[model samples]
Structures are given as C-alpha cells and as structure tokens.
Target: MRSTTEQTVQPCPQCGTEIRTDRRFTTWCSACDWNVDPVEPDERPGRVERMRRGIAHRYGERLLAEMTGGESRRPRRDVAGVLACTVALCVHGVTVALLLAGVLLVTLGWGGALPVLGAFLLGLAWLLRPRFGRLPDDAPVLHRADAPRLFALIDEVAACAPTSGVHAVAVTAEVNASVSTYGIGQRRLLTLGLGLWEITAPQERVALLGHELGHFAHGDTRHGVIIANALHSLNSWRYLVAPIRNPSGLEVILNALYLLPFLAVQGVMMLLDQLTLRAAQRAEYLADASSATAASTEAAVALQDRLLVYGSAETFLLRESNARQVRDRAKRDEPEQGLWDRLAAYVESIPESEYERRRRVGALRGHSVDSTHPPTHLRRACLLAGPAEPAAVRVDAEAVAAITAELADARRVVARRVLRG
Candidate 1:
C-alpha cells in the first residue's frame, strides 16, 4: 500500500505509469508490474484491516460448513429495510383511511362541498400504493427442455447453495451473471452472461454460478426488495408532487397537503435505505466465500480477476470493436472463427493497468455504506486467507465436456440476440 495523499505523480521510465515518489520502490506499476521489489506481507495489512478480513473469512467459513452438511440457518433480516417498507405502507394506509372517512362523512355531511376533492384523493391513493409486481423482462429465458446441460449446471449449483432454487433462468449478452427476484410474489430469476461463459473455463463457470447462488443463500434481494420498492414509491411521489405541469388553484392547495409532509418523510426514508444496506454487504462477503468453497480457490480467484478485467475501459472498447465486427460481417461468408479470434486478440493486448483501475475503483463490490456488497478486494483478501476447504464435488469429465459445448452455443445465441437489437 502506498500513500495516496500526495497528488503529484511522476511517470515510470519503462512503463509510462504515474507513480508517487515515496512509493516508487515499493509499489509496482499496475500496467507493467514494474517495481524494485515485492511488498512484505506484514507491512501491507494493518491491524484494523486484518480484523475486518478475518471476520469476513469467518463468515465464509461458517457458510461453507453449512453447505457441507451443517444445519441451514437464516441470515439476519434487514430491520431498517423492513421498517422503511412499513413506513411507506403506513403512509398509503393512512391516506386511504382518511380519504374514506372524508368521503363518507365530510363530503356528505358538508352539503357535498368537498365530494370532488375526496374522490380525487381516493384515486391518488390508489395510484400511489406499492404496486407489488415485477417489471417486464425482454431478455430471452432458457428452459430446461431447450438447454439441458445449462439446466443441469444450474440445478447442481442450486442444490449446493443454501437456496430453494431459482424460478427461472436466462442468458444475456453482458459480461456479468446475476440472480434476482421478479413479480409480486418475489419469484427468483437466474441470469447468465454469454461474454463470461466465452472466456471462463468449466471450473470458473462453477465459481460464477456459486456467487449468484450465494446471494440467494442470504436472501439478499427478496428481503431488500421491499426497501427498494418503498424508496421507489416515495421517490415517485416526490417527483409527482413537483411542478411537472402548471397547477390550478385548487390543485396547488391539494399539492401542498401532499407535498410538504412527503418531503419531510422522504428524507427519513433515504436514511433508512442506507442503514439497511449493511445486510446486503454481509450477504456479499459470505457469498464470495461460498463461491470459493464450491469451486476451488484457484477458480474462484480467477473468476474474480476476470470480473475486474471485464469492467475495465479496455473491455468496453473490445466489446464495441467486436460488435462492430459482428455487424460488418453479418452478411459475409467469412468464417465465424475469425471474429472470435479477433476478439481474443484485442483483449490479450490490453495493459494490466486497465484491469488494475477496476480493482482501484473496487469494481461493483466496494463496501460503500450505500452499496450492498463489500469491495471485491476485501472479499478476495478474506477468501485467500481462509483455511483450506476443497470443492465438494467436481462434475465428471463427460458432463463438463457436455456443458462446455453448450456454453459455446450460448455465446452464439446471446450474440445473435444482441445483433437483433
């Protein structure tokens, strides 16, 4: 670790990398791995860093033991998140109750002076209730019948992880994989990315699946979805109360009734959202360890490394270049192998520093209070330090062979879908 406080950085003579003078000898250039010497382990991680890493590793170890026939346990729920949803629901309930009471008594008893207002409030409350439905998805779903090998892989991962199983599965063109809940009832959906499959080895693919399954192991989304939906509802009203259109005198007065209290409550909801994010971060750390336990440490670490590379600017450039090639060659009789070759070549040419930037940015895994996951660096540190726990099972070579072939087809299928878009 180097002192990042100093803003001035001089260029490395060989690699043209920016470097602070104090760290020049100890810190390597990420692009070229250029340095005077390797940093000693003791000097790198201080006491507080060691404690956090150790705790994360311990959580992973417990989850790994559970996967190995120990009793299945529920990860703690996010109380703050539930409370946020409760507050949101209470707002809707109170508004509805007041509307009903007003319409039945005030409007009727006051000679119909406020009948129109009461009716309007009733409609507004209906419009603002938490619409407990999943958003529509355009990505193509992969059925077990259509892709047995893929399904087999999914099923195997599901059995090993601490989840009941996903409700649906699909593949996409992105370089990432995710497991999410959809619809009003919180059904699960698993999404696999073709780009990751194209680059990953069989073992690495297992690591990736294990990570998504890990999210389910902790019920990260199903529980957090409430807080998310609550925030979405509140934010929706926040904007709804804004002067989106010119207000009539009567509308202005009604808006004041709704807007003032909503603004005050909206600030409180934001605070709760951050408070509830802690559970998500814990889920992520344990899940990272789960990935390592399911796959080998080697495979898990490799998959994580590739993820960093996947986020780098170089990857974006490579993807666009490949896509442009695909479009250009759409009508060509040229071999498809050439396109794959070109893509591999471009990615191999990128400097290591581009990937390092992803690590420095902490990728999507940072432990920011607002984020659900710990940084990829922290997760990896914990995992690498853990006591040995070999993978429970490796799919037989024949099954691995079958799935590997299916993986290739998946890449083509996803690319074609992207092409259509």
Candidate 2:
C-alpha cells in the first residue's frame, strides 16, 4: 500500500499565528507573511521594456491556457508565419536593390555627381548587410574528441529530444545556457554556463540540454537566418535614424529629415514583432514539454525551481568577485582555487523557504528570464500538468566522473576570468 503524509502544524516565527506546513513547500505565516521575497524586483525598466513586459504577461497567460488545454504542439504553417517571411524577404530585397543601384550608378554615371550618390548608397548597403551568428573567438571550444563522455551525454539527450546534435560546445561564466547556430554553414553550437551547470543535479542537467536542443527540434522561428538577419537590419536602421540629444543647427535639421524614416522603420519592427511573438512563446512551451520528456517531470520542475534562485546566485558571484579583489590586494601566497566548487556550494545552501518566497514573487510580478519566455510559474504548471514520465536518458556514476574530468580545464579558465573580474 502507498503511504500518506499530512501537513505539519506550526506557528509563525514572526506573528505566533498557527499554520499548517507542507513539507514540499514553504512554511510561512498566513497572517503576517514575514520575510517573503526579501529581494524586490527592479522597478526601473525603460518605457519600451515596460510595454514589452505588459504584452508578454497578457499573451503568456492566454498561451498557457491553450497549451494546458492540449493544443497542437507542432509549429504549423500559419498566416502569421507566411506574412512574417514575406516581410523579411522584402527587407532583404531592399538591400539587394540598393547594392545593384549603387553599382549601376558608379559604372554608368562617370565624371558626374551621380558617383557621389552611388558611394552613399553603397555605404548604406554595407552598413545594413545581413549578419550571420558566429562562435565567439575568445570562448573555449570543446570538440567531441576532447570530451567524448560529455558529447555522448549530449548525443543521448539529442536522441531523446530527437533534434540534430550540436557541432561544438563552448563554456561561459554566465548563469545561463543556450544553443545557437553559427557561420555560413549554420553549424550548431551549445554554450554551457558553468555557473548554472555546477549547481544542477544529473537529471536537471539533462533537462537543461533537452530544453536548449528542443529549440532546434521545434524550429524556433526567431532564430532563423532570414528573420533574424532582417531584425538585425531593422535595428541597425533604427540606430542610424535615432535623434541625437542636445543637437544644434544642421544636426537638428538632420534629425527632422530622419524622423519620417525612423517612424516607418519603427512601425515595421512592431508589426514583425507582433506577428512572430506568438509563435516564439508557443515554441518555449513546447520546449519545456520536451524537457520533461527527456528528464522526467519532477526533474524538469526542479530545474524551473532552480531558475528562480538565479538572482541569489548572481549576488553570490558578485560577492565572491569582490572578495577575490581584496585578497589580490593582500598578495596571498597560494594560487586561487576551487571557485566553481564554492559557487555550487553557495547555490546549494539556499533554503527551501527562500526558493518558495522567490517563486511567489515571480508569480506576482509575472517574472520571466527574458522578454522572449513565458513566466516561470506557467512553465512549471505546464510541466506538472503533463504526463509524469521517467527520464529517457540516464548518466551513471562513471560517465559523470568522465564528463567532469573533461570540463576541468574549462572550469579553471572560467574561474580565473570570474575571479579577475
């Protein structure tokens, strides 16, 4: 027979009011609610960010409802997708037309002022060129030969996610992980952040990989070359046309001349964002479901819970960085060591009550990792509401040790950079 447990009866530490405590959740007073969310969210977003957040919060709620109601998970070829593609193609066509016109003017209108106009057109075309993503030259790249065990783990997770495997792995000091395509060939690269990697359990690591690779499997339209390059071009155009502050004389006249183009570009950007935002949000939900499939529902939910504490993790990093600076001034004899281990310990030391407090705060504020993703609470809810499946890929102890050994050099390099900064 299965066993059942009940909530533990307790009194509020601050209010002395009796309360029932669920072991799986936070224990806090219902009356006074002491020490809930000690850290408050920043209230200093710019006008644009605020508007985006408002839109994200409203749409995220609607998307969550549809997903939980068992809507189709596959990305469909809809009118929005077609319209977005059409707009992107038009943007690229404009660039191509500019290049051709510039060449024609230069060749046909020799010994005339037309050549000057051609030069100006050519400069504009150069500035607005499409930019493909590239692997950072400075980041340490890990190939499969160098880290077979880690690559094997990634390959296993890719199979479970049913996505094409990554071509290379890069490590960074940030508290995040992502998969991006780079170069003309669009070779996939997985950027793993040591700050997040060190804190996650084995299964949570699988969920992380699954979530990132899931982006590939789901065809996240935001990351596509055509749309991404068009967005980049629009942003560059916006920068070129932006009005300068404290302008005098002809600068003011130039700003006036640029105003109409600025407005036109801004309108197009808004339209494109609106068309793509829904699909992008839906893709995130599907990726979370994929993560649950690969790593089990419990581990996926736990990974989301860990995400809530990243603010505290960042705080710890800043603190350690500050402390490292002080030690350097003292001229310590021994070489610095164990920075990654300490970071892991610091994150692991956070209390369950604190996590619960942050979770509640996130829900109240509609907090998200970025404007692109849905609220963390909604993601957790979707995962929990789905089937409770076992992990599809498992890492034994031998594999874990081997993977850790492979990451040792990367860990050292990242530690040094973090400490020095």
Candidate 3:
C-alpha cells in the first residue's frame, strides 16, 4: 500500500546495504557511515545580522550572502556577539546613568533612593564581572628571527590563501595547529604542533597549512576572540550577582530582582551561541574547501585520516620521543629524521577495522552544539565535496628541513622551558 518513493531504498554508497527511504535516515548508511550529505560550495561569511533582535538589521546579512554568491545556513557567531557587546554597553551605561542621577538627586536635596540604587547596580556589575588571561608569553615561542625558513613557508601558505601575514609562529607539544588573534588589531599568533608536523607527510602538511590559512582568510580567528570575550563577559556579569548559597529572605528577594532580567539575556546569548556554533562549523567546511583548492583532495583526506589514527597513538609517540632525548641519548644512535615514519609504522599495525570504528564514532558526533570547531569527519566530507585541485604551492623543502632540525632542540628545551616557569 506504500507509494513507490516511500518504499524505495538506495544501496549504501560504501557498503551496498539498503538505506531505508521510508525512515528518517534516507541517505545514511548504517553499515558504512552515519553522515551522508550533498555539500554545496560556499564562501559567504554567514547570516549573522538575523541574530540582532533589538533594532535588528535583518536584511543586511541577506545582502551580504547574495553578494558573496554562496552560503551555509548558520548565523555568524562573532557578529552575534555584537548584540552581546551592545547589551553589555547598555547595562554599563544604565549603571553609570543611575550613579549620575543619584549624585544629582543628592545635590538637589532629594532622598537617598537614587544614590542607593546607583551604588547597588554598580556593585552588582563589579561582582558579576568574569576574569580571564592569555597564556604566558614566556611559553617557548619561535620568532621569524630564529626560524626565517619556517616564516617563509608560512608566508607562502598565507599568500596562496591571500590572508594577512603571520606576525609570530610558535612550536608547541600539543598535536594541533591554531591561529589566534590576540586583540582587534593585534598581531596574530600562529601555533603549530610539533606532533602534527612530525607525523604529516609533505603533501598532507600542505593541506593542514591550507586549512589553517583558510581560517585566517575568512577572519575566523579575529571574530572568534570577540565571541569568546562576549560569552566570558556575560558569565562575569552573571557571576558577579548570583547568590552563592541558598538565598535567605533578603538575599532571595535580591537575587530574584537581579538575576531574573539577566536570565533572559543569558538565554538569548545561549541560543545565539548555538546558532553561531553552527556557523563556525560551516566556516570550517568552507575552510576545508579552501584547503582542497590549495592542495590536492588526497592530501586533505590523507591528513584527516592520519589525524584520526594519530589521536591516541600520537600522545604515546610524542611522550616517548621527548623522553628518549634525555633518558636514552646513548641508545638513540640514529640521527633524528623526525618521528613520523616510526609513529606511522606503529599506527599501521592497528587493524583497519579498528581505525574505521574510531573514525565512525568521532565522525558521528560531528561538532557539539556549543563547539566552535567542526569534527574531522565533517571536514573530510566538505573536502570531498570539492573537486581536487592541483597543488597550488609547495612547502620549501630546504626551509622546512632546517626548521625541523631546529624544532628538535626546541622540543628538548620545552620541558626545561616549562620548568623555568
């Protein structure tokens, strides 16, 4: 009795199992992948203007999207923070206004009402303010002065993506690469993990560079700071006024008065955060597309696939490699060519089925509702959506090799550097 379309099912693309059309999962393949998609090419920043509710400029984002000719249906997170910042400013202005009004009332010989209210608001604001600080500058950083060759390579990557020049690059023990903007117009900090670089093949490394450069290209780094600060500032405000213990009569009444209004603002911010997170994930997809355009798709795929395997295995490899430098210098007779090959060899010994299982679990999770970054599988899917481009740039072999040699010493000094702290 079912219609033809409803009854029909397509064979799984990867494993040829029947994908049920009648079910909610029409395209998903259980025996193969949970994620199935028709990824469209996109460069449009996002529809963030829709999020500006009070005196919202609804059409501005539409215009931007139309102008860009590509879009992913998620509100831009950083731009949404503009509303948060606006709310913060308004709250601050009101507090200042109350104090000034109170002063005027006292001068005019009015009762203490205005001054008392002003003092209360100001004190609440101060208490509610959140605190955060940047990572220590003393953390071992590699400057252009020390690693010109590496800087040259980074410059090459930036040029291909047409992004701003990196101000400083640092090597870290973490297995990741990140570019962060310190302030609105501040010099961007680029951190490349020795673990990721040590494991990446030359071509695959280009993909990683391209993806990170794409983040710069799209201003994701700059905007990310704004969104983070906005969220933190809001939390600070809430913290300043929230009752620490169970509220007694006066405390309960005061909390109800103070927190009720802010609760609505917090709820709005949370919703905005979710929307922006989706946008951030989409930004990641767009960045992956940029990576595919910069390097070969194979390179991007290889990098992602390798990253999955390297996740658990990498921690072990980095620790062993770092520990070996001091503990077994006598045993390490071989000239250090970097730990990629040996680490990879060890990972390859892992069953393919096991790797697939791990990849599946991670991919299925995608990005959490609040996560600002997308999952690796989502990135892989996005890269696959784009047609492969010929490698647009090559990492300078001489420069990279020289940098790697320097990084070995950098790694050796990392523990000691931290200890110096």
As for TM-score, the candidate ahead, 1 or 2, is: 2
TM-score sort, best first: 2, 1, 3
Predicted candidate 3 versus true structure: per-residue lDDT over 192-256, tens digit per residue:
77667766677777788888877877655225544555565556655665554787888878877
TM-score of candidate 1 relative to the true fold? 0.67
Model 1 / residue 318 / CA error / Å = 7.5
Q: Could you give candidate 2's per-residue lDDT for residues 1-421 as a string of tens digits?
A: 1111435788778888886654544567656766554555566774445656666877888899999888888768789988998998888888898898988888887767998888888898998888877888777889999899999889888887788789999999888999988889999999999889988888899999999999999988888888988988998888999888899998999999999998888877877787788888888988888888898889889999989878767777888888877875655434456877887876776656557677676777683436678878889988887679799987788988999999988887777777777
Off by over 4 Å in 3: 1-135, 221-225, 241-258, 313-351, 415-421
- Cα RMSD (Å) per model? 9.4, 4.7, 11.1
Residue-by-residue lDDT tens digits, candidate 1, 209-313: 888888878666425555556566566666666543577988788777777766665665455544454555556666776677788777788777777656432
Candidate 3: minimum summed lDDT over ten consecutive residues — where?
48-57
Candidate 3 Cα deviation (angstroms), residue 149? 1.0
Q: Judged by TM-score, which candidate is best?
A: 2
Would you estimate the TM-scores of all the predictions? 0.67, 0.89, 0.64
